[model samples]
Target: MAKPITKIDEPILTEKEKQDQSLKEVLQDLSQNADGIKETMQLLQELHESGILGAINNLVEAKEQVAKIAVGQMLRPPVTNAINNAMAAGGLLTEMNPETTKKLMGGLSKGLQKAEEGLQANKKVSVFDLVKLMRDPDVNRVIKFSIDLLKGLGEGLKD
Candidate 1:
């Protein structure tokens, strides 16, 4: 015999049932988000042609700045001594010839300062931002310039 229809199949939800439905939706969303992150990791690993270059460029700039500091420290002791003395002079300004010394210090200090700012700024770039820049004309131009620079060096070697 055909089974009788039952109230158990009625279309009504208890409070707990409603909460369970909401929780399931939230879990599904979280699962999707997690999947998205895994995809991004896979993409990053496979494609080194994106903002990775930009990050390297930033890192190279930072290294150049550090190199400046290292190089500047080796300057004529007289100049180094002057900068040190200027700092010791201490006045309305934190130190004397701040601008001059800063200039002398070069990109290393500037890069370090920028890094400090970036760290403190806590700014985050989204994956969308990365993709956008990777497709940007200006970004492509810079990438091309970098490639041309390497090609020039290679040609110089062959010549």
Candidate 2:
């Protein structure tokens, strides 16, 4: 008859053995992610070499002071005005029709170019010249557009 097989009793690990087991597990993990660890080390090295790490460390050290300064600057009249203006512009842009805005911008650019040409030519506009220009189709179109724009602005203000 064949010999009967028996289960062995589990043995308790000693402190050294436990430490060895943990080290082995850590080594296994490091081996598995060796490439990632290497890339991370390289990135860290580059950051350190570029002095960015030191700068970041300093920034962290003075975070509260830096924050206070930034807040103070933001609270200044000019900075607050700029922020408010930017927000207002953003709201205006959101409400505007994209196509109409694009057309208006294009027209403004062309008008600027014409104005530049007039400036370069050193031509002075007299009252008679102004009356004559008013008769021009382009000038008449722009005038009508401006009047309509003003009327719309007035209506918006009333609301």
Say which candidate scores most in TM-score: 2
Total clashing residue pairs per candidate? 3, 0
Tens-digit lDDT track of model 1 for 16-117:
999999999999987879978788878876556667857876878799787888898769798888988877675535644788567646745775897899
Q: Which of the numbered candidates is closest to the native, going by highest lDDT?
A: 2
| Alpha-carbon lDDT, every model | 0.79, 0.96
lDDT by residue (tens digit), candidate 2, 1-159: 988869777898999999999999999999999999999999999999999999999999999999999999989999999999999999999999999999999999999999899999998789999999899999999999999989998998994
